[model samples]
Target: MKPRLHSQLDVNGEAFAANREQLLAQLATVEAVGRHQQTSAETKREKYAQRGMLLPRERLSLLLDPGSPFVEIGALAGYKMYDDKDGSGAGGGCIAGIGFIEGVACMVRVDNYAIKGGTISPAGMEKALRLQTIALENKLPFVTLAQSGGANLLYANEIFAPGGRGFANQARMSAAGIPQITVVHGSATAGGAYQPALSDYVVLIKNQATMYLAGPPLLKAATGEIATDEALGGSDIHASAGTGDYVADDDAQGIAMARAIVSSLNWSSLLADIKQDIPAPSYSPEELVGVIPANTKTPFDAREVIARLVDKSEFLEFKAGFDNQTLCGHGQLYGEPVGIITNNGPITAQGANKAAQFIQLCEQSGTPLLFLHNTTGFMVGTHAEQSGIIKHGAKMIQAVANATVPKISIVMGGSYGAGNYAMCGRGFDPRFIFAWPNSRTAVMGGAQAGKVLRIVTEAKMGAASDAAMLEKLESDTAAFVDDASTALACTARLWDDGIIDPRHTRDLLGLLFHLCKHADKVTTRTNQFGVARL
Candidate 1:
């Protein structure tokens, strides 16, 4: 493999500066929304301080190893949904990410109790399910900082049925030999009580933690039996009753005990030693911001991105002359071999065939696949149709769906129509998927959608169609589609794992590859049923 030249993107050009500015402005909007959510959670800091409890984020910081990077997922979930008239209720009332605890990588979930008593919303439940899927796939331990008022009654109807899946995932993870540790810092009544009870190890704070099927008021109302919270399911009572594995005096102590438990698991001993002295990419990752054009319709070489992501700007292009629009290549990211599939333009019949062959070859070699999505859709014209686009496109989708290797996707630009499925969108269950701040994912482009609707309406109305009304209809539809297909909007509904900064793409990919490799190397003990308390 030879090093690729980086002459295509002129970093000093006016176009580069303009693109950088636009991308930065878009990134700033996302950052502002996340900061607003953080501030809303912090508003109750004084209230928690008065009660001798640390804030949700504070507990997370103490639980994680010092100086470990936390790759947060779903930071902007449920934005402006349900009771969130303002956009401050993002993150779905929880903080979740993958980070190192006691030098062992684990999926950490902390309920944002300061906000709405850490109530779970519909989007919150979706986010949790996605997190669980990630943990299961990566074979990571699950650690939850449990403290919640249970499901938000406002959306109980929507969350009740699917909520059981979370508990089921907990049981399956434990049965599969993935450790689940929970630290209950406060209220865990009703449905929330099962979260700690199902865990392999539970840490309860003496006076602050409470986990019970029914609270005092509910107990009294249901059975006419008056009982205090402490007598019902307090930390001291649970410790004696064998429900809790450890009891602590405060939030900080509980976190310490949880960390100690993780250390005692000796999980890090199973991991392969980290590689040293890996070569950095020749181009600066900062150039990624400018590589994407400010105009969505502009065409750029996908190799420009591959040049800056692969180690030392080296890549072995596969079938370079077969179909230029669909690039297939082999590259090394952080010394791990990867087969990359990215779109430079629409997926033509030839491009689809080329991609399908490349996918099969990668699977044969047992190499992981990386997809960088930017296609408008499959080529759509009489010529393309005559060339067997549908037949060839289905083959590509089948290859993507069945390939056993770890599939990771980054939606860098337009991911429209069947192009999304072919490129491994959220539906195909890529091990992990992320989107750039400027990316868009929809059935089709807004302008194309508007035109299609107008044509259909005009055909139905025939000679009675009003020119002005049709024009307004087209414009309104276009505007709505564009607004709804933005990166922020897609992330709010849990479309992608989360929207990420373009500059961090390489590092994030490196981490994900490491995790997938570790999961493949390690073996887990499986049983017929999960661990249960006696």
Candidate 2:
């Protein structure tokens, strides 16, 4: 029989209150950055209204089924980078997420034309590539609300080469039978013209949408030819020439046409019916905000987290007597069976062996794996080395890497060194990875890294080592590592999917589990060549 975990937390204690307050502050910071992007886009609301066009978000709302959840991806991309002097250009000049359109879950990418004319920055390109990968892997239909100004000419040197990969991905997706539907709401000139052209279905807005390989000036410069945007590649021209499948009078109608196209594909028929009645965890998910201490150095039982996440607070622990530092168990999350792996301390040799065996068992059962990371790393020292920590750690990593089951990771606290890899971190290709506001990821803690560097430098300097120089070096290195390992910094570089609130963790996992389940059940028709507009 499975055992129900008992609560050991002191909800009314001072420590819990302190931790909750700190986490709330961190969440506020993340929300504030999101608001900056919204404000930046809203600054152009009047202009969009004057043109009789919906705002980027408005179009997204209309495109998605009413009241459906939208899980935004890469919200902090390009935060305070490139030409963005302030933090306003946070969303990488676009909004992309997974949402339901006509009851069919789809990967939706909408260019934030309100910000910088929806220019494609380097970060924006990376975000788009990541989105395409998710759609391809999950077998979700791709929907793009295209209106970008193409590559930002200022960074054309950096963008000109890699930009071609976007078009290639589009073609590959089409050939893989993943429907790519694009609604061109505005100008798509230069390289941007290929976005709609490569889609399996294209919707163009009448006077507002203009798609061409070159605008007037560029055409005149290259071939001494002058042509207006409408005359070159407008909706009327594209519809007549067979480039666009549908033409709408405005943005709203274009979105409606895209929805109709998605409905016509009948994508929802592929989703397996989920009829199980899921019971909520006995403990409230809200308590998760206080489970991990604000000062990550403080230790808490990993079971506390699992109790609040799994159904009925029940877990069947694997090898409970063999190791205590590494916790491995089986539990049902949102009525879906999952193998839960978490850490209570640095991984010892015995813990690695236990986890490796547990992973294999889960694989044999075809259950999905969930990794909750919060470890310093594998144990190190003369004793650990003598005990074959290296060999055991490698075995654990090997199991994680070769496991064919769906893996999802949440960096709840510190994730350092080999521990990250063994726990299916981003590098291990967890189907979806997220971090909490207080989480930190790095090779090692800043202080530990600084001391290691100091020791190495002292040995290299021999007896002539300068103590003052070493102190400064250690301090600077520590500061840099700490800053770079922050959740904000890691997310800006697309390290994880996004930083999520602890309170919403269970719900997010539920959605991801559903998507992965659907992907495993659906089959697609493929061809050597993608559908082409001839």
Candidate 3:
């Protein structure tokens, strides 16, 4: 395969400079939100120190191998929900990432007990379930630094039913030959006790860890039996009564024990050694900041972005001239073979058929598929409608939905309408989906939606409304849709993993592809049923 030619891209032009500046501004907004959440956690640092407890992040730092990268997920999960003042309560009361522990990749989750006692919000529940799903799919060992107050009772109705699935996933993972190591850093009471109980290994922090179905207050109220915290479900009792596998002196010791447990699992033995002699792209990664237009309306070749991401800037364009709007090609990221599908414009019937054929080829070869979303959607109007777009568009969607290989999506710009579905949006369950800070996702463009609604309203009213009222309706609808489709709004609801900086796109994709490759080599021993406690 020859190295791609992105000579057509004007990397040094004024438009590129403007785009870079705009991307930076958007990146700053997303990063600032993450920092705010961290600051919120920091507010309790002094209090935690007074109690001889480590902050959640401090524990996480010690848990991961020193100098290893931690790719944090859902950093802005709950930006402004449930008593979160000043938009500081991000991450939904948890810190989670894929990081190395004793040189083994593990999914590490820490309950940010500093914030609202690490109560699980609706978003927090969603994050927890998603993390479990990732660990299951990637065959990564699961490790959690537990200190949560359990599901927020205020939103119990919202969380109660779905929350049970988290425990179910843990149970199934254990039975599927996946190891789970949990460190009880603080309170893991009530429903939280199931987390450690279901784990293959549990480490309790002496004098600090608590794990019980019901705490002292609830025990007292229900049974009229007053008891101390330790008596009901203390570290001593759990360790002596078989509820905990190991007991540690404090948070540091507990984390050390968890790392040791992971090291002992022989998890590395299951993975085949993969040599990654990947070459850097011919283009500088810094140029990525400018490749994407500041405005969604402007168009740029997706190849320009791909040039800076793939190894050696090499790409074998599948059918370059057949359907230019839909770009599909074969490339290597970190020396791992992958099929790339990116949109340059709306998906015409030809484009849809092109992508459908590309997806099938990738699936047949067992290559992972990467979707770079930037389409308004499938083409519309008379010509597009007559072109059998609906027929071929459905074919593309079917290919995306049913691809056997790992599928990942990155919402780079306008991800609207059926284009989002065909391009492997969150709805299609791509193995992982991420969005750039400048990304926008909606059923349709805001202005288009407003116009559609206005037209329908005028027809129903059967009369021309006052100019001022019609104007207000159109303006209000457009404003609402625009706000709703913003990257921040999508991220707060966990639409994608996290709004990532454009410059880091290559690094993230490489990491993900590496993980998926490792997962492909792993084979899990399975049972008909998950393990259950007596």
Candidate 4:
């Protein structure tokens, strides 16, 4: 009796149409979830086999947006393992995809740790190369989270890994113009080391990561060199040897490092610049001296000096450890943002290179540039020569010259040598150059000048007592740079636009932008706006 009355709920047949559409969405969603779960489970098994490796797809889930859809390349790579009982691991050999880092489009490759100890398979190589090709074509940054078992030893008989290039393409992909980041969340030994070397940057974990062309066993067998794994390819080794650029503690840390790099590149600049306001200096230029110390030789932290002088102390520092002699960062004054570069203790070649990178960051970001001049000279020694000091120093000068932003030169301290040039001195094309009353412009500092003068004095007073001649030389060199002030150098030759107080830095910077000429970017990137972090 009850079943007869229901009539299959046909009373609202018309309503069923709208209900059908509503349920269709839910039904599709459910089906997708079901399929996704099933595929994910199969993927795990495919990646691991007997070893229980996690496929790139699963790793992407761990590394990228939750439940984000990814399109993979080289998903069907394989090797001799395909003929074995287990068959080749998933993605066949490669791990390539477009997914979301957070919610933005990001390219990623996750080494399948479950398969063959997550070694680079033939398919993996093809997938990586294919992904790199796609990234360059699409102008997207590539992030590779690599953790592999050296190489697929089982395929030694094969000419190449089943997927593609053995390991040579990693270097090729790196040079192809797209920013590639190699993140070592775990071991990346032997052939695996090549990827990070070719990348624009690399992020490595603490103890969990190792990246070396050869492990200790090979080194011991070939060269009788018994070395610890850490000594072979640790974070400190690469970063110090100039192989790795950045270091991280874990997967999260590696991801953060990648994010920070993305921020430093092209995206954050636009975000910061497009806004009408930038950090501005709150003080006057005349008050600059108060923020700085009077003694030239006394050691003081430039960071402290910067904090005391800028409108607001908030500034982003990049590679602070690498360049102790020079520093660059971002800060705001009067709500307007500006790029700041400062020199310290004795300018070394390393400092110069860091300075150049800083200058490029500023120029590329469209942020106004400011110079806090201080230098003895370019590091002139054997150490300087070996560190590619000349090249990096050139980069600094070139970066300044190439910059089109409003530049304000603040001679906060000494300006010596091409150090003056490096600091956006006369020729770097800063919109205008200024000097503090205390700034002493010279090619070399008084101490440095005294060394040269000592020889002259010694020669002149060849027969005289050494003490008397040395005293005169010291007196003369002491005031030489001091005499070379802004008025004497800048006003005398019209090299400088004006002089201002240390406090008035922000006002002058704002005014400089308000006055200087500007141009559209002249970078190699095409229409791509820039890559941003997740």
- Model 2: per-residue Cα lDDT at residue 479: 95
lDDT of 4 by residue, 1-534 (tens): 000111122223554344334334433432343244336446557434443334445556666667654544334334223332333454433355665564444567777664455655444444455565445544456788888775467654442544335244444444444567777767777667766665667787776678887789989999998999888887788777777677776566677777677655552121123335544323223333343444456554566556644554566776778977787777764455677888776667778777777777776877777787777668788988898878888877787787777677766667778888888876665545665545567767666677778877788878784887697877688667555442323323334433344445555455334323211221234323222221
lDDT of 2 by residue, 1-534 (tens): 479999999999999999999999988999899988898788898988998888899999999998888889888888877887787777787999999988888999999988888897888888888899899989999999998888888888988888788889999999998999999999999788888999999999999999888888899999999899899988999999898999998899999999999999867642345436788898999999998898878999999999999889999999999989999999988878899999999999999999999999989999999999999999999999999999999999999999999999999999999999989988898888999999989999999989989999999999999999999999999999999898888888778989999999988888888788889887888998888987
> lDDT of each model, Cα atoms only?
0.91, 0.90, 0.87, 0.58
**Strongest candidate by lDDT:** 1
Worst 10 residues of 3 by lDDT: 268-277
Report the lDDT tens digits of candidate 1 across residue range 52-89. Answer: 99999999999998987788999888988888778887
**In candidate 3, which residue ranges exceed 4 Å CA deviation?**
269-276, 528-534
- Candidate 2 residue 65 Cα shift, in angstroms, is 1.1
Candidate 1's C-alpha runs over 4 A off are 269-272
- Mark the 10 consecutive residues where model 1 has the least summed lDDT: 266-275
TM-score-better candidate, 3 vs 4: 3
Clashes of each: 0, 0, 0, 39
Candidate 4 least-lDDT 10 residues: 1-10
TM-score each candidate.
Answer: 0.98, 0.97, 0.97, 0.41
Candidate number that wins on lDDT, 2 or 4: 2
Better of 1 and 3 by TM-score: 1
**Model 4, global lDDT:** 0.58
Q: RMSD in Å for candidate 4, one decimal?
A: 27.8
